[model samples]
Target: MTDEASAPGKSTAPGKSTAPQASDQYVQSLARGLSVIRAFDAANPVMTLSEVAARTDLTRATARRFLHTLVELGYVRTDGKSFVLTAKVLQLGYSYLSALSLPQLAQPHLEDLSLALGESTSAAVLDGTDIFYVARVATRRIMTIGITVGTRFPAYATSMGRVLLAGLPQPRLEEYLAAAELHAITPRTVATRGELLAVLDKVRAQGWCLLDQELEVGLMSIAAPVWNHNAGDVVAAVNVSLQAQSVAAQADPAAYLESVRRHVVETARAISQDVSAKHGDA
Candidate 1:
């Protein structure tokens, strides 16, 4: 199953540029090469030459050349018939993750929160229309898909995504609302711009978000923002997710969830303080 909350659609070939056709800076070949690499995913980790060509919307000759180039570069491997990405592919994102201090700083806090709450804790940063997971401490699998450091979910459907959205400046937030393709991941997802704007206003004022089964049928999550003191803006979000049944079983479900929200907010604040101390607000 796809880790993303949204339903699958046609994969856009990276080579299909959204940039101006006359733009001198565009690199079509690089985009096509990346498209070939992206053609492999959780559901189709190993694919034949024709399969890769069809997925990437590239000619068989072009796909074969890109695949062989990637294989030679150690980013892909083939066993005569099917090709799969190699561990070396992760190196592509290593530099960015290494330079970002949020994951390193948030890991300990997430681990502690997960230990205390007996739930999964995660940290994510807004990446385009999605929240890209940077660190995770899972006590048990609450989602159908196994969540790992690189997993991504629609920002509109997830607690961490809403927290990040709430942190955005008004202009950017409006731009996002106008451009976002709002659709229902679940019945509870806020799929309308007007509803989402109201929710974001509340989340911004309250400095936290509690999303109940919006991203998935049985999952519930609470999130708070992690700030960049120097920029005075949110750089990431931290959250804890548990099965809805667990909260329902509590003697006082509202109070139990409130306590969890408090813990999540405290952890987020602590991480923000640490970030401020290390990066300095001057």
Candidate 2:
């Protein structure tokens, strides 16, 4: 069996990331191993050996080997005829949480932002072509779209992605842009390089960004970058999302945008000082 570094969206059954880069001799084994785990998804959480083999594109014997190895490691388990995930799988994501000290640090401020603004708030970092939601505080449960931990969305269409991207070095930002096209989730989604670059420039100059239903329809968002005080580097971004109806109900997009931006920026500053400080460089 071979595992490849899984890209975020493919088999992303809410698959946080399943796509991996092509492998050499050593990484080949690792890719096959991870691929075994990714074979499980929301639709097919448990599977027989052959199902796992088909899902992973591995031979039954190979899938069994990797699956057995994972079961041995406590990350995978067998329940009757099918294989399933174990609680230990959380450790992989938890490691990132513990290492970053982000979710714990940002929760309080994020909560405040959501409550005060009567909207949803989130924090995230770039993951290839997508924005991976790290922490979220949502005021409404029945939002237009469901967002859970590990949800990935097109960065080209989100406020948080743009603000964070604005802070990236020119060469890196251009590289990402060159590889990215404006995926129009809605008519509002910027579909060309020129428009996206222009919007990104505005995000940089104004210190905030507003995305109006570009990713998810009837949902508007605003975001601001959080920077490290010591390094002066933008580490991540915080965003506020409100229902499109609500935004329109208010009768002023610019005013609401400014308000949301302020809350996001202030919360981000708190996150930097309170959370980043705990890290060695913070």
Candidate 3:
């Protein structure tokens, strides 16, 4: 379920080093073991020992030791030559998801919206330059990529991402824009900083965002922010996704847009209210 190809290795940069300042404070071995766990993703679900070593930037002997340790711990399994993560690995992600009430609170709302509109609905929170989907209800497949809990996509190209990004303070937004890698994933993706800033401004003013074919060829989505009632901050975003071709099939595109936008906004507001009621500062 991990989206990361490999959890990043410690950087050589002075301020970014993961080395313990004091010998007793940090365990480099533990960090390397975690890196091995993060190396498996959808693209590389199963890997040879050498592949794991290459991905984690560890020596063959070191990587093999960690893999054997994980196998003994029941987090990984192997068939002589290739190793793959087992179902037990899900426990790690489940622990985090279980601690947060947001996913549970938003599930019913997402289900209802998906059932009512025949579209996919998802909720996500920003993580660095990516948006990780925590909860989702899929009515049908709309993209080549399959999205499930823990799935992630670039924030700059998604409707939900833009809504969350728009909620950031001006200085933070500028900092993100300056540092983010805005590669053009699709022909319509907003890759330039100027264009992204303009889009963020529109999202800020409208309190919602609509992205069309920016992430993939035919996918369209509308999203609204889920506000934290106690703190008055955007904590997550909710979105409804449909195929671009479906838009024209409706009796009126304008009416369809209005209805979808209204429902999505209402769904996000309901989730926010639920979170506020259940957990004061969540």
Ranking by TM-score: 1, 3, 2
Question: Which candidate number maximizes TM-score?
Answer: 1
Give the clash count for each candidate: 0, 14, 0
Q: What is the lDDT of residue 260 in candidate 1?
A: 98
Across residues 149-171, which tens digit of lDDT does each residue of candidate 2 receive? 56556677778888888888999
Candidate 2 vs. true structure, TM-score = 0.77
Candidate 1, run of 10 with poorest lDDT? 2-11
What TM-score quantifies how close candidate 3 is to the native fold?
0.85
The sequence of per-residue lDDT tens digits that candidate 3 reaches over residues 1-282 is 111111111112111223335567677888788888877765568899998888888899999999999999999999989999999999988888999889999999999988889888999998767778899887766776567777667688889989999999888777677656777776888988889989999999999998888887777899999998788888999998877888979889979988999999999999999988877743
Instruction: Tell me the RMSD of model 2 versus the true structure.
Output: 5.6
How many clashes would you count in candidate 2? Answer: 14
The global Cα lDDT (0 to 1) of model 2 is 0.72
What does the lDDT read for residue 238 in candidate 2? Answer: 86
Q: Over 4 Å off in model 2, which ranges?
A: 1-25, 36-84, 142-145, 178-182, 251-254, 279-282
Give residue 82's lDDT in candidate 3 (0 to 100): 99
Once model 3 is optimally superposed onto the true structure by TM-score, how far is the C-alpha of residue 236 displaced, in angstroms? 0.4
